[model samples]
Target: MDYRDVDIVNHQRGWDGYFKLDVYELRHKQFNGRQSPVIRREVLERGHAVAVLPYDPVRDEVVLIEQFRPATLSVHKNTPDMPAWLIEIVAGIVEPGETLPDVARRETMEESGCSIIGDLELITPRYYASPGCTSETVQIFYGRVDSKNAGGLHGLAEEGEDIRVFTKSSDDCFAMLRDGIFCNAPIIMAMQWLMLHRDRLRREAASTAI
Candidate 1:
């Protein structure tokens, strides 16, 4: 008698590229104890990913990265004011055998040239990038780091990732969040989470100095 139950009539595979598309013909149970009409949905399967915000408590700064996104470029190509290059926190696809923290740290190092100093803090629970058309879920984390020497070019050539890493004060990051400079959801969410817990993190760091 579960109203959430869904019956799949047929599942078909579509384009097999970096992202695989899955088409499903399905029917769901209605609240009135009846089955609804068949619904066909196409889902993009790009696998799950991890996003990390590298924060240096001692410096009151956070490491951010910039990169060119083709998809984003297409969206802004007609708009002269918008740039194709986007600023974002460190993130990468979660490998099959790797844990969330593992990928977070690895991606942080690969993209930012900074080593995580303290333990990785879970920013929040995992979230869906796009539930309507994709099965991609993202887990975001807060990795404590020393950002004194965190800048430079990074990213794997094979992956076509040319990332530029930079560190900005927490205040500046917050301002960017407020100004809607970031187009992605994870960074904005992470920044909001940091705003709530930043004093605790800095206080912990300050206490450790004593």
Candidate 2:
């Protein structure tokens, strides 16, 4: 059934903070073509976000970043294998009036001190971070960049972000991916696409230079 088939009985704010929570009591058309009983669901109102993978074609490298995330604190503390600081590509939530591409480039600079040089190759139109609870969607891209000088600590002080930026050759990145070092979705998607198109991209870049 389409979204119109679902009825939203009541929607009210449950929490107001950096992230919002909306309480929903609704019913939808079931598979049997019948109305279902009302169910309560609390959805996180995170809005949209953007993530960009910075790839240096000439150098055949990528800019990566690491930052602490409190969401995984419990797992990181209890599970020895879990890391509190996650290895992630540049990502940030979309602010009011900013486009998806705008946020991608902005976050790239803020998190990694790298600016997107050329056109951004849209990797995924919508990467639903977690569809079960959050309404947050991410538009992912891979943009050309110069990683020669793209290393340092970044992120806004007011936001309490202490991002560590570094670069890794495309080969090393692939090896790390194979070792299952990355657990985030955006990195996985971007790395997989690079794995499938590295040769073609290199050829195109070489031709453009010559």
* Model 1, runs deviating above 4 Å: 1-4, 77-82
Worst 10 residues of 2 by lDDT: 73-82
The root-mean-square deviation over C-alpha atoms between each candidate and the true structure, in angstroms, is: 1.8, 1.2
* Model 1 TM-score relative to the real fold: 0.93
lDDT of candidate 2 over 1-210, digit per residue (tens): 699998999999999999999999999999998999999999999999898999999999999999988888777677779778999999999999998888988988888888888788988888678989999999899989989998989999999999999999999999999999998899999999999988988898899994
User: Candidate 1 residues 1-210, lDDT tens each?
Assistant: 563499999999988988899999999988898888999999999899999999999999999999997876667768766768889999999888999889998999999998998688888788899999999999999999999988989999999989999989999999998998987889899999999999999999999875
Clashing pairs in model 1? none
For all candidates in order, the CA lDDT equals 0.91, 0.91
Listed in order, each prediction's TM-score against the native is 0.93, 0.96
